[model samples]
Target chain A: MEPKMPRKERQIIATTITLLAVVFIYGYIIYKKYILENPELVYNLEFWGRKFFLMIPIMIGSLIILMIIFAIVNKILTNQDMETMTDEMDKLIELKALKISRWSTNICFLLAIGSQAIGKEPWVMMAVLVISCFAGAIVEAIAKIYYYKKGV
Target chain B: MGNCKIKNNIRTLRFMANEMTQQELAERTGVTRQTIVAIENGKYSPTLELAFRIAHIFNTPLQDVFSVDPDDLVLKKK
Candidate 1:
């Protein structure tokens, strides 16, 4: 394909990178708790569990805010492509991307469940779930770009 | 899976239309320039409705825009 690289694809890529950074930072922080100075933080299951519960809203809000910033950047990056509505081909690519992303997330969920069944730590479960969700978003963005450039 | 396909003269049509840019053609056809490029390069085949829309944007008949080989069909022509 000629591959013009649309604004939407750029936005998707920016968002994916941001999500990966966030996920990696979160993972590092969790890892620190387990290995760093007061190892008690890792054993504090209730605290991590509560923090994990609170993370849902925090992550959602952060992603929303980040996306808005990315959108503004995208507007500045492209001229008229953003003004146009998504055509049928674009929609089809989106559908395919979402399917692959969701499929990845579901597989990650199964892994989390299996870990929980094996009596793994709750913090590990939380980390895996949250990390994998972000990973799925990244996967979708990559897949979308691939299909757009290489054909569906 | 590659047994059948549609062919088009989008590049020729664009050339004839005063060297119309892909972006302009995409805007007229309500799709992204990337999609137009893909279609022109035979990397992607658009839906029937999209094909009609593209042909309409070029002010040409569907046959002039796209052609499917009868032999490629499950039911071949005599």
Candidate 2:
């Protein structure tokens, strides 16, 4: 038995894995290219601008592909039992996860202020903000999985 | 909620209803079998509407399917 995990829970777990993989892979590449190989790129806003601009498409594309893959497999396995709609427990779990993500974002903002006040470099602050967003996303996904496992 | 223990007789009721499996009951109640498992194991309490739905599925009274035995202080008031 596959344990009959709900489609919603499965989607949450899959999405979380995708986001984290992308973050780590993309983060490493960006760091090696800008911070290690070409240190001067960190000082240049154009480098950050172009890199993130490219990432927007890459991230969106990867997410869409992931969704399609999950849908295909889920439809095959669940057949008529495939449920894509939200239920009360799903909504509650989503809210619980969203609450944690929002709190993390607020903390990120506070840290952003502190970093600025302490005279950190503009690019360093930018990196912190980006990583914080990733952390928020990772936390949200983990919380959803946790609630799914423990019951909501 | 302050020592409020929500309990259900879903397992006993299912057995009486022709040895119904969790999947069968879940399909009838429009919930996942895991949710049925959670409810039976006392890990999660369903909402009032869902509770009523489950009772209806089993063709039993809501009071018969689920209950919350009041604490001593609350029971003393009865």
Candidate 3:
């Protein structure tokens, strides 16, 4: 309506992008500083398993906190409520965006499995899996923004 | 066809209805204001039920509220 991203959705996307950036930076640091320091950890399934398991809760917690902060700031700045009605169009756009995200993630999953089936290292599969998930999420967010601004 | 678009008279209808606001229309139609804006601007098309609801609100037939582009029909005929 404003020729820009709707306020509530804009904040959600902004928080998502911010959290994604933080995760990427954190992953990069861990890989470069910690994993490289202990090369054996790369081949250790237990280490990867723990990292993946811990990351899920941490990511969720961070996202919830960020969303709350954004909501508070938005209320202070614009005096608009965070909650909004979801209508048919919103549902339609969400389904379309989700379809795009699913396809991208599925393709990456196949690639990851194929790498494992071949002779690629275990770490390669793990990296591909992680990247595929993040890429799918980012793509979904971008698709939502596009559809919201340009119409679905 | 991709070339065919559903044109609507929502803007005219709103204006004729004592300059009804998009927010009011949205509330009457059980949707968001942005959704009403999108429909009026022809950026999005409503579903059959939604079309009926809008027509009901304006006390018009569905055909009066929405129609296909005549040019598209000509292209189809060609």
Best by DockQ: 3
Model 2 CAPRI rating: acceptable
Among these predictions, the greatest lDDT belongs to: 3
State each model's CA lDDT, in order: 0.78, 0.80, 0.84
**lDDT value, residue B76 of candidate 3:** 46
lDDT of 3 by residue, A41-81 (tens): 99887888788887888788887887788778778866766
TM-score of each model's B chain? 0.85, 0.86, 0.85
Off by over 4 Å in 2: A3-10, A31-38, A46-50, A71-82, B1-3, B72-78
lDDT of 3 by residue, B2-73 (tens): 556889999999999999999899989999887888898888888999999999999999999999967776
Ranked by TM-score, top first: 3, 2, 1
Q: What is the per-residue lDDT of model 2 for residues A1-152, given as tens digits with 9 covering 90 to 100?
A: 25376666778878878877887888789898668987887878778878878877888888999988887887676665455656667778889999999888778867877787999877877777777787798889888888878876
iRMS, candidate 1, in Å: value is 1.3
- lDDT string for model 2 (B43-63, tens) is 778888889999998899999
Task: Kindly list the per-residue Cα lDDT of model 1 for residues A1-152, writing each as its tens digit.
Answer: 22355666776776777667765676577667654866767668687777667666766777788877765765665533244477777898899999999999999998888889999987677767876787788888888899887886
